[model samples]
Target: MKPFWIYYQKEMLEASRTYKWIWVPAVFLLLGIMQPVSTYYLPEILTMSGEVPPEAAALFTIPSADSVMASTLSQFSTIGLLVLVLAGMNTVAGERATGTAELVLTRTVSTLPMMGAKWAAMMTLMLVSFALGLAGAAYYTHQLIGPLEWGAVASGGLLYAVWLAWIVTLVLPLGAVLRGPAAAFISLGTAAALSLLSGLLPSRFQWSPGRLSSMAAEWMLGAGAGAWAPVIAALLIMLLSIIAAAGLLRRSPLSPQS
Candidate 1:
């Protein structure tokens, strides 16, 4: 247990030191900032470009600050999964490819603990990035319009974050199962396929994790608690995937070096 924390701490420190780490938060925040800014000013931007007719422009106007805020939250809520896919794609696979994973596993740490440490770090990074992005988007939304339902906005943000975490569970295991570019490409391709399938599936299948990316914002606007069902279900599935991956990983032998 103590060793797990040590490894977890090391991974966190390494993550903080990497410049590439900046891209995760920056990209998420940029999308977050863009959401509200675009929602608030889209009409004006379109008008400047003469894209909307005077008669049509009247219909396109924002009704209230809440809807604009909702629209902003919705925009990034769906798109934010890409952040998880990109960041998590290389997590375990990169380590395995470079022989670092073998080095770590050779220590007293068990396979479960080693995987847990990485999973914990990945989970923390994902949540923190999403939260910061949400706060930034909220502030921008408030500035563009007036005060918003902060409670609703915050809840929506959290729902989206959880949804993203669930998606990461799926990707992280694939990262652990495959190595290097093969793992990353496979995870990314799977993400795209799942997204496409989710879109075409029936409403009952909407409970799937893939749909959470699209449904989170709606969860906020409607019954905030209702979304928890799918979110929790997805989390459970993610945990199961991790457990299964760990079992597979524990049985596999590390590649021998001549």
Candidate 2:
């Protein structure tokens, strides 16, 4: 077997044993369902809460179907992103810490395959989790809101997935250099900074990968039909993260604890 695939299989087996495959997607599914259902029932919920004005229910307006779906992706942006980052934070760093890095490095001729495998496994989990969560959100959106344009939804989901992949990929290189929690913190911080800067200077940073989350929402509204700059930038960043991870692991294949 190819080294990369071999290591990828190991990662998969480990993921199964750890129940990550089950719980991660479960969280995403719950988040996906919560948005539409909550939106659908917001007025009722507020009324039940007994803190609003008597006239508030009349002022409540149900959002459009596409908007609700887009907001579901936004939910993924905050809590979903946090869960995924924490889950993948230890890809390399944990291996190094547990002394697995030394064993794997001793067997392999190069760290590139292991690094590639680690990245590929992460992409697998991210893709599957997001796909499940998006599916759940889409199903609820269609059932509650109305019919949706599958083409735009697919495009938007792809943009958002790539945006997610970019951040998750950071864990690989960061894990090679720092402890697991530190890697997660730095990666999340970088993502937040980019997103904040992009929001503050959109015209100047339209090509930023940070616009991807917004772009995903825009696609749901059929507003980003021709936008491609952010997608390209995200791809470039993903490539860079992969390359950086390989180099960093080559330099320090073992963790401080090991």
Candidate 3:
């Protein structure tokens, strides 16, 4: 077996033992429950806000209750992708910051394997969290909102997760490049900025991961056909990001103090 495989197993075991591991799935499950429930009730809440004058009410075409729920899920997922950044930001930088990298290096561990192990562990955690969240959301939405076109929702959600994962993959390089949690902070800033900037690009270039981050939730809310291009692009980017992150880790300077 490869050393990185062993290292990956160790990292996962450590993460599982930690208390915070429970929160990742728990919070996502809460979002799943809240999103649909809130969507169903939002119209009533708005109506209770007090009857607008006839003229104002006439101009406002209230969206359907189902649309409201979809919008809530979409919005939540957009912000929630940041959870990836938070989960990964310290994947590597924390080890270096605490001088653990030196200890790991002392064991005859190659740089590539160490980095590879960390990346694998982080990606595994990410994939599991995303799957759990999507499963919960899909189940609750189906139960509460009546029958949905799950094929559309599943494809959209999976694609969006892929895009977000690519965006998160940058955190590994950032963590390797910077010390401490600064990498995570930079990853957050980069994801947010890229999401905003994609809007300015031409539609031809819009299928990139950056655009996916901004519009994924909208697609989940039923943007219709042709959105699959970006979805496919996002998956491609996820693969590319992992390769790029590994290469970057391999090239980072070794600690002289070690």
Candidate 4:
């Protein structure tokens, strides 16, 4: 347990030194705030660009508050997720590739605690970044657009965060076995494929974690998210990711790719 905290602190310090703690949240806040601002000024923006006629500009309608907030979340679903995944892609792979893992494994009593600490640090960063981004988005949406149901925003944010955590968790195991960029690409690719499949087969893939993104938008829009299956499925996947990574780290501390 003590080792876990020690390792966790090291991971966080590294992130801080790298300015991840600053820029990541800042990016999320920017993404969130931009949604409502851009939507609210769409006509002005179009007019300034001179790409649209006055008649066409007049036809543009500002989305409702809830719709804008939902769209803000959608921004996280794509670019936000990409940024996080790329940032986390080297968590484990870098250690192994640089021979840092060899030193840590020698000093630590075992791999489980070290790996658990790594996972916890990653989870903390993801949650904090997402929460900040969501808060920023929600605030701008309310001020620029309209009132939002606080309950819906909280619930929807949790649901969306879960989906994100699950995707980011892939970095641990994938980074353990693959090179850094390969892990990032494969993780994002897997997430995209799952999201696409869930969208195409909503009825058949009701329990898919990918559906959580859509369900989160529905929640933000004051819609019932139906079953808790997606949340449960996401949790299960996250647990599996930890187990898989821990097992892999235990078995192949020196040669992760093997």
Give the TM-scores of the predictions, in the order they appear.
Answer: 0.84, 0.96, 0.78, 0.95
Per-residue C-alpha lDDT of model 3 across residues 1-258, encoded as one tens digit per residue: 487887888788877886336766666666656777666565666556766555554555544434544554454455565565776776676666666766676675356666667667767776676667667766766776676677666666665666666667777667666864677777767766766667766464666566664465655667744556666766675556556655655565443343
By summed lDDT, the worst window of 10 consecutive residues in model 2 runs over: 225-234
Evaluated at residue 70, the lDDT of candidate 2 is 92
In model 3, what are the clashing residue pairs, if there are any? none
Candidate 4 wrong stretches, greater than 4 Å: 255-258
Predicted structure with the largest TM-score when compared to the true one: 2
- Scored against the true structure, residue 59 in model 2 reaches a CA lDDT of 98
Q: Which portions of model 2 show Cα errors greater than 4 Å?
A: none
Q: Write the per-residue lDDT of candidate 4 for residues 40-135, one digit (tens) a residue.
A: 999999988997998899999999998888888899988899889988988888887887788778786677677778878888888888888888
Per-residue lDDT over 1-258 for candidate 1, one digit per residue giving the tens place of the 0 to 100 score: 987798789778878887436877887788778877877777777778896786776678654665665566555544565666666766666665566766666665357776677778888888877787777777887888678777777776777777667667665567666754565566556656665787887465656666665565665455443565567777797778777666755655242331
TM-score of 4: 0.95
Q: What is the clash count for each candidate, in the order shown?
A: 0, 0, 0, 0
RMSD to true structure for each model, in Å: 2.9, 1.3, 3.7, 1.6
Name the top lDDT candidate.
2
| lDDT head-to-head 1 vs 2, winner | 2
Error of 1 at 252 (Å): 3.1
Look at candidate 2 and tell me the lDDT of residue 16: 85
